[model samples]
Every structure is written in structure tokens, then in C-alpha cells.
Target chain A: MDIKEYKKYAENRSKRTSSLKNCVLAFIGGGIICVIGQVLFNLYSIFTIEEHAKLLTSASLIFLAGLFTGIGWFDVLAKIFGGGTLVPITGFANAIAAAAIDNKKEGFIAGVGAKMFIIAGSVIVYGVSFSILYGVAYYFYLLLI
Target chain B: MKNIIKFPEPVSIIQSASVVGKLEHEGPLGQYFDMYEDDIYFGKDSWEKAESEMCRRTLSTLLAKANMKYIDLDLVLAGDLLNQCIASSFGLLDCNAPFLGLYGACSTFAEGVIIGSNLCSTHQIDRCAALASSHFCSSERQFRFPIEYGGQRTPTSQNTVTGCGAFLLECTGYPPYITECVIGRIVDSGIKDQNNMGAAMAPATVDTLMRYFNDSGKSANDFDIISTGDLGKEGYEIACELLYKNRLDMWGKYTDCGMLMYDYKKQDVNSGASGCGCSAAIAASYFIDKLKNGCKDILLIGTGALLSPVSVLQKQNIPAVAHLIHISNSRN
Candidate 1:
């Protein structure tokens, strides 16, 4: 069909699209996601053990985020924010916590230990898997050196 | 010949444009950021700020497109996933449109449409508009946890779309007919796995889709397209399998908002999707594209998981629901 014809038809079908309310909910939900991130950053800054401890702070943030994911607070945020909560460092935490929590009910060894690795393990595996592939390039650099 | 009732006036496109913004992953915002961002640590706050900025930009584009003044619109109807509807409210501030805040989880889009259609249909407000926006950040913090608290996520978990979508519906002298009322049904499966939301909400999606088919007395083949919200790969597969098993073969085209919004190849996202806005945004952008292309009869199914983390932690199973909206171009 011609451009004009297509445009006309498109407008007719467009009504089915979600109205403004849904978008607003999502936007607010997105904002809520950021608020949590800010709070975490603030807490990390306040609990500084040493000067210029960026690595330590980052690690703690990751751990705390995961811990909250386990306790169910992060999940609640996920529900409220929708995509907002799931897209950040908090999501990583949620993944780890979910694995650990999911395993906790089964038992510490196979359940807890095995389940805890459900998501984190995958991250590590993927990380290692890709690093190995890319690490080959590093080996070449070492050989050249 | 079907005696279809047509609203004397049509809805006009006073103006329309989509805006976008970026965010950092941290706390509340991270929830949304996590949905779509592959490598980033921005959180809900960043999502919120970005979302607000997007709305402002979209509103500006709408005004520019329509070549009208901000004060021209009689009313602005909006909604979001946050507690007080901050992003919509804040972003609309730039648009200068009068506001009406609403919530329907993922169904907010329809809510806006119904209300906007009514306002224009009744001629109660001339030149009124409706807008909707969803961001990744703000949603995470309020519904889940703060970044400072930190947490772990499940593989079944869906990452929020690190993006926002908006729509502008205007009332015109020649408005699109508000044909049939396709209300959503709340179906609960009592399954608590957030990761398996598609499974949890599958029943609802199927139930609603079939019911709408029965109510309309129309077969699945009658519609040109069928769409669902947030049912990603698992939910989508389950929906088709169950529908096929029940002998309710959906012959029409079908798609999910979660699967289409982002390119998985570039992102490598596991399982298709999440986020209430997934359906909303898809319905706005993609659906419009389809409609404009001449495909008429359409079915829109929006699925939502009513299971909260607190409820799950409290030992409650998850419950999911789906709402079906029917759309067509048979208004004459």
C-alpha cells in the first residue's frame, strides 16, 4: 500500500495501544528503581572502612544487593517498579539471593549449596567461558612480549 | 450487516512523539534498569530521572507536532507503576497538560485509553489528551529493594526494559469508534515463583483470550493479530500450547510485548522479558505500527503477576491474571 494508505490504517489500529496511565505507572516505577540505587550509594559512602575503597564498596554493594534479593525486599521492589528494579545492580543481588533462598528450603548441601549457584554460578561460568575465549588473545600478547 | 455504533466524532492526533532518556542502576531504579540493561549499574533513581526527562521530551514533541500551545489541552490523563505516580506527574509538568493519575499495573495503558476515549466521546472536554510513560529505574525501588540493601535475583526473574514509551491520543471531530469493551479478568494460579510468572499468569491469559473469543462469538482466526503483555517466551509458549491443546487454535498472528521491545541478539537477554510497562509500551509503539499497516481485527492480552515478594516470602503462592482487549477498524 502507499504511504498515506498505510498511515491511515496504522492510526486506526493504534487505538489498541495502552493509554497514558500505563506509561505513567512505568515511569514512576522507573524512578523508584533509581531511588533505591541512590540510597545504596549513600549507605556505601557512609560505611567506608578506608579511603578510596572503590573496589570494597562495589563488592559490598553487590553482596548487600544480593542479600536483600534473598530476604525478599528486592523482589517487592521488582513488583512495584516492574522493569525499574530489575535492570540494575539490585537485579544481580536478586539473582544471587533467589538462588540462595531457593536452595535454603531444600537443605544446605545439595539444596543450599547447589541452589545458591543457580544464578551466580551461571554468571561465573559465563564470565569464565568468555574470558577464556578472550584470554587467548592475552596469551598471544604474552608470547609476543 | 452488523449494526455497529459509531461515536459521531473521531479522535484526532493533536500531537504525538516518543521521548527517551538514560539511567544508572542502583536501587529502586535498578529494578527497571535491570530489565533491559546488559551492562550497567544505574538504579531506580536514574530510571525515574530518565523517565521524567523522556515524558518532558515526548510532551514537547507532541506540542511541536500539533503546533499548539501547552495550555491548549483541556486535560491530561496518565498512570504508572509507582506509589504516587511521580514520573508521569513530574514529566507531564513540562507538557503543562492538566493531569489525571491512574494505575492498572500493566493494564494502565488501557485505563488511559478508556478514560481518554470517554472524555472525548462525551464531548465533555475538547482537545484533551492522554499520555503514558514507563521507566526501568523508579519502578524497582518502590516495588523491590533499595540498592544499598542489595539482594539476589532468580533465573526465572525478568529484567526490566531500560527504556520508556509514551503515546498521545487526541479527541477529534472524527474520532475512532470505541467499539466493544474487552475487560480483563483477574486469574490467580497461587504459584509463587516470580521467575515463572508466565506460567503463573498463563491460565489468566488463556482464560481471558478464550472468554473474549466466546463473548465476541468470534474464532481466533477472525482477528488479524493477537498480542499479550509480558508473557515472554515461556508464557507465550504455554499460552499457545494450552490454546492448541484445548482445540482453540489461534490462527491469527500473535506476538508478545516482552519479546519484541529489545533485540536479544544485541542484549543476550535470557527468556524474553519482564516489566509491567512491557505490554504497555509494545501496545503503544508496535501495535500502532501494525494498525497503520491495514491489519484490522486484533486482540490484545495483557498478563500480570499479582505475586509480591513479601507474599512469596510469607509462604504464599503466586497468582497471575490476564486482561484481554479487543480492537478493530469496523467502526462505521
Candidate 2:
């Protein structure tokens, strides 16, 4: 085939998948996760202080996400949910716990313990760095007000 | 000079061995493989080590079957998907013979056969060992994502087979022998999707196949089967459509090891099996054996997408190549 001929046809040959379905699924999945957190926050507030209840809400969600990652069900959710499942705190727990489960065969100290933070490491580093920047921005906003 | 070269003198496939993982063992052709390791680790600490051990076992098993030691062979040509081809290096490290490690990714097996054939026909070496291996976990962790990541895989995503194929080639042995080979040229269709490797490779496969046919002055009808390495279903369709456009019809005689790598309905493998082990395992264990007891000639083309994870990250289009080897069982 000629180079000129191929260049014309190449665009048609390549596949471009539709993103609408993934986006919709991700929206629903993210909403469900947030709703679960809200329910947990309300449930814990009756028994504990509001601040502790807020912390417990995130903890429970992370636990649930970790369980899903350990059992290999997180991928199923992530398959449909995509970024919706990936953007939340639960995704962070899934990342860390999944690494541990994946390396379980390699023994604890060398495998699970060492590899427990591969994906989550980057998220934590960026998350902390971004929070500091956000805090500075909020302080300036409060001063102006 | 064109890449197409004919070998008048037959290069013998004296012995072969295949070592496959459990997923492969569950496939239809599982019973035919030389060895099956239920454990992916094979008692090794890491997936890389397991891949190395898998290659080592294939080489050792082939030598034992042929009543020859590593010292008996003049050279060993090996390769794999690992960074720096370390898998092949460590896999065949204990062997006494001189080693030449190659990196053609999934096409390493075909490259081995081509180079091994050249060595044999030229009388540079009497006996040579050509081997390749790939582990799904090791390769995925190296190239794409961590298995624990549970990333969503598209339909175009191919599952790398955790297997190894080893062949002992000599100046003489069986009826089915290597007769011709076409070293493929890199044909970049400007395909950038790393997950759609088949699409990246299909153009190269078509280029090589067309060249082979043009050089031989015969269409696909001349060969019993025109088998490609790892095009799977998508790439397979693309290649066939391209062939049909060019007026060459395989007439359903075209097959791919990727498509044959697993039972599609029963297996969750997205786009069938790939990697150097994909074709090598199938050839060493199944097709080569079939050809040895067959009636006609066959053309085996091994395709590879020559892109590393770094290359993918850089957003470079994947360049691909497909090497061809002609095998004939006819002695007269």
C-alpha cells in the first residue's frame, strides 16, 4: 500500500470508543459512594461527636472499598464506574489494600508491606501537596472577606 | 535486496518443549503442552523469576527429550518481554553454550527461528536452541498496570500468556523443516493505542504477508494455513479485510495463535493471548507437532508491536513488524 493511500485510510481503520456510557456509570457509582458516606455520617453522629462521626464515615467507606479490592470485586465496579470509583477516598483504600492482596503470595514484610503503597503513594503525595496550596488559597479568601 | 529469503537446505526442528501456566492448561490445547505449572510462581519469589524458571525448564526438558546436554548445543538464542531481556538472560544463564539474547517482544520466537535457521544453513553451528517466554503478571506489571490495580480493560486489550517454548534445531531431523523466511520491516500505521496492539500490528502483518506472496508469486492458496502470531479477533479481521482489499483471500485458512490461545466463551481474556510466548507455545506444542504429521506446507507469521511502556507514555505511535517462516513436511 502507498503511504499516501494508507494515511487516508488509517483514520477510518482506527477505533474511537464512545465515552458517554462510562461517564454515566461513573456518575451513578460516585453518587452511590457519596450517599453511603452521608448515611454513615448520620448513623455515627447519634452515638459519637460530629467530628468523630465524620472520620468514622470515611473509615467505613474505606473499609468497604478495601474489602472489595481484596475480593477482586473492585475491578468489576471500576470497570463500569471508571473515574467515579477512582476519584473518592475509597479508591485510595482500594489501591493500598489491592497491592497488599496482590503481593500476598510473596510473603508479608518483603511483599505486602513493601508494595502496599505503590499506587496510593503518588495520590498521597499529590493530595497532601494540593491541600497545602488549597489551605493558602482559603486563608487569602478569608482575609479579603 | 528484499527481506524475503528462501532456504533451499532444510533446517531441522529436532526437538521442542512447551511450559504453560494454569490458564493455558484450561484451554483446549492444554493436553498437548510438554509441561504445565499450576503455580504461576513455579516456586520463584517473583513473576520475573517464574518466567525465567519457565524458560529454563523448557530448555532443560527439550534437551533431555533429545538426549543432549547444553554442552552438546553450539548456541542458544533467547528473548522475552522483560526490560533489557533479563528474563532470557537469567532463564538460559546456567546453560554452558554461548547465548545470544534477542528482543522482538512477541515476535522474539520467530526471530529466534529465523536467526537459528540462518546459523544452521550457513553451517556456523550444528545444533542451536531457540527459546522465548512471557508471563502475564510479570509483563503486565512491567508494561501496563499492576494486577492489583484492577484497571478496566477494553475489548482490544490482549492477555499475555504465561508460557515458554523451546526448540532444538539441527542440520537434520524430521520431515517438516524450515524452508523460507521473510524478515519483516517496521510498518507504522500511526496507531497510538497501546491497548489495541492488534490494530497496531495488523498493518505490519499485511505488509509482510503481501511481500511473501509477491516474492513467492503465489497467493494464500498455495499454503495450507497462513497463521499469524497474535492479531486476536480484531486484528485478524483487520488483516483479512486488508487482504481482501488487495485481492488475496485466505479462504478461512487464516488463523491466529492469539484467537486460539484460549476458549473465548469460557475465558475472560479480553482479546485472547499475546506476547512471545503466545505463538511460541502454540507452535512448539501444537502446530509444529501437527505439521510434523501433516500433508502440506504452512506459513507462520509472528507479529510484534515494538513499544515499551516508556514509548507509550511518550505518546509515540507503536511501530510493528511481522516475520514469516515457511515449514514443509514433504521429504521428496
Candidate 3:
């Protein structure tokens, strides 16, 4: 058989990710994380304003993710949670922290400092560029209105 | 043209030893391994060093089993999955014999056997050692991601085996002899997904197996068992289907080291186990034990995907190779 035909056949035979199972698990996992965030927000709100509570809640989740990653628990959690842990702020923190820990052997400046953003670099770049583009577009619409 | 190399004289595998980690120790063939370490680090500070240490201890165990020392060996051929093959160099540092480092990815162990057997058969060397190793933690950080990275593994992805296997080959000494070998050609199957190594490597397995059958005029029925190293479940099926299409059927007799290394249903490993150590450890322990028993002949085809992280990032298609070795109980 030719390469093209074999490629097509192999693709058909290979195992695929179970989208339905992943979706259900992600819903439950993400829901649990959000519920934790909500509880944190309420506890913080008892001591401060709503804005401060919201900021503190996000900070708390990021810290927890980083701590879990450092302690080697985040990957195990992510394995079962799938996208539940990935689509949250915790995932972003885990990404950076994992990279930093992995590259730590190469020393600080070239290793941890440079490669810390390796995974999240693209996300940051596209996010900032699109936000700037949206800001300029909205400013023009506001002036015309 | 035919690619099979028939040895003029049989090279005997006098002794073989395997060292595996906790997960592998819990596998089906766990009892066959010579040594098992519950600690992934093997008392080392870093993962890279742990891999080197595994290789060092494997060679020592093989030498001990053979009742020989490193100085008694004429040559040592070793390889691993680490960049620059550092594991082999650093691990075998205490060896007092001449050494050659090979880089065949997962197929490195078979590649070493082929070379070592050829040298022994030709009388260029009296005794030679072939060793290969891979640590899951080390290979993961180098090839895919950090162990602590919070990312979901695809169903096609394989878990790298944390183990090492060493073999001692001599011109005359044992029953399980290396009779024939076929050095594989690089075959590009146009597979680009890094996660799907089985698909990338299956075509190479087909190419090598077809060439072996055509060159030797031997069918799948000639061997008691034909095993491929580190192809996992996906590649194993594809190889079987492709070979059947080419008029060579290996349905029942064929199996894979990757598939045999882990229990897919019980273990969290997505497809199965992989890496240089997967084939090496299995070949040295389980298959060698079979040869020692009543098993007549077997064929071990080591399949490997020759793609680096840089090559994958650059969008280069994975090029794979499969090296074949025919090991038999009788010298003839």
C-alpha cells in the first residue's frame, strides 16, 4: 500500500479521545473548582468589599494551583479533571510553575526565567494583541457615536 | 534488493538482565525482571542521573550474571533516549572496555544487538555487551512535557518505560543465538502528530518485515513468535493490517513489547508503554526466558520514530525505522 492509503488506514485504526466522557468530567471538575472559588469569594467578602474579595479569590486559586504543581499533585488532578483544571486560572498558573520547575536545573536566568512563559507565551501574546485591537475599534465607535 | 544479513556463525547471548521501576515491577512480566526499584530516582538527585544510574546497574547485573567483569569484555555498545545519549556515556563510565554509543531512539537496543552479534560472529570480538535504557521522568521532560505539567494526555500517547536491559553476546556459549538480522531503512510515513507515535512507526515496521520475508523467503509461520518493540497498540494493529494487505499474515503470532509492558485496562497509560527500555527490558527478560525454555525460534523487530522535539516543532514528518533480529534456540 502507498503512504497516503496507509496514512488514512492508520488514522482510522488509532484511538481517539472520548469527547463525551471528557465533557462530562470537565463539567464536574470545573464546577467543583468554581464552587471552591465562590466559597472563597464569600469568605473574603465577609472581611472586605466585593471587588477586593473577587481579586483575592482569583489570587487564592492561582496560589493553590502553583502549590499543587510544586508538590506534584496538579498533574494527577489534571489527568482526571481533563479540561476542568485547564480552562481555569489554575491551569495557567500550573503551566508557568511546571515550566519553571522543569527548567530549574539549567539555572535561573536562562532556564527558569526564560522558559517560565514557554507554554503561556502564545496565550499572552494573542490575548494582549486582540484586546488592543478591540480597544482601538471601540474607541473609534465611541467617537462616531 | 534483499536486506537481511545472515550471520556466518551464530552469536550466543550468554546472559541478559533487566532493571525496572515500580510500575513495570507491577506489570505482568514483573517477576522476570532481575531487579526492581520502587524509587524512580534510584537514589539519584536528578531524573537524568537516575537514568544513567539505571544503565550502570544494568550492566553490572549482566556482568555479574555472566560471571564476568567489564575488563573481560572486548566491546560495549549502549544507548538511551536522552539528548546526546548522555545516559549511556555517563552510566557506563566505569566500564574499562572500548565503547560505542548508538542512537536509534527506541530501537537502540536491537541496533546494539545487531552490531554486537555481527562483530562476535566475524571473530572480531570474543565477547560484547549491548545495553539500552530510558527513564520515564527524564524522557518525558525532554520529549513531551514536565512531569508536573497539568495537561491531559491524548489516547494515542504512550507512557515511557523506566527501565534498562543489558545483554552479553559471545561467539560460543548459549542456546539462544542471534542467527540473522536486517538493518532497517528510514521510512517516512507522513505522520505529523507527535502524540500518535504508533501511526508514525507502523509503516516502518511494515517495510522492514516485508523486506525480511522477501529476502529470507520465510513466512510468519517460520517463527514461534514475532514481536515488535515499542509499537504500542495502535502501531501493532496497523502493522498487522498492512502486512496482511501485502500477503503476509501475522495475526496470532505477532505481539508488541509496548503492549506487553503495561496492562491497558488497569494502568492509566493511555495506549501502552514505550521508550528504548520497553523493548530492551522485555527482550532481555521475557523473550530470552522463553528461548531458554522450549521455544524454538523468534523474531524481534525493534521499531522507533526518529523525530526530535525540534523536528516536530518545525512541522517535519516523523521518519521511523525497524531493525529485525532472528533469535533461535539452536545455533543453526
lDDT of 3 by residue, B58-85 (tens): 9999999988888899999999989999
Off by over 4 Å in 2: A1-43, A67-73, A80-84, A99-133
Quote the lDDT for A48 in model 3: 100
Candidate 1: stretches off by over 4 Å: A1-145, B1-16, B20-46, B94-96, B145-155, B171-178, B307-309
- Best DockQ among the predictions, by candidate number: 3
- Backbone atom clashes (below 3 Å) for every candidate: 120, 0, 0
Q: Native contacts recovered by candidate 2, as a share?
A: 0.34
Task: Tell me the deviation in Å of residue A106 in model 3.
Answer: 2.2
A66-111, model 3: which lDDT tens digit per residue?
A: 9999999999999999899999999999999999998888889999
Per-model TM values vs. the true structure = 0.60, 0.90, 0.97
User: Which candidate has the highest TM-score of all?
Assistant: 3
TM-score of 2: 0.90
Candidate structures ordered by DockQ, highest first: 3, 2, 1
Model 3 alpha-carbon drift over 4 Å, by segment = none
lDDT string for model 2 (A40-125, tens) is: 99999999999999999988998999888877788788877888898888778888887887777678999889888877888878
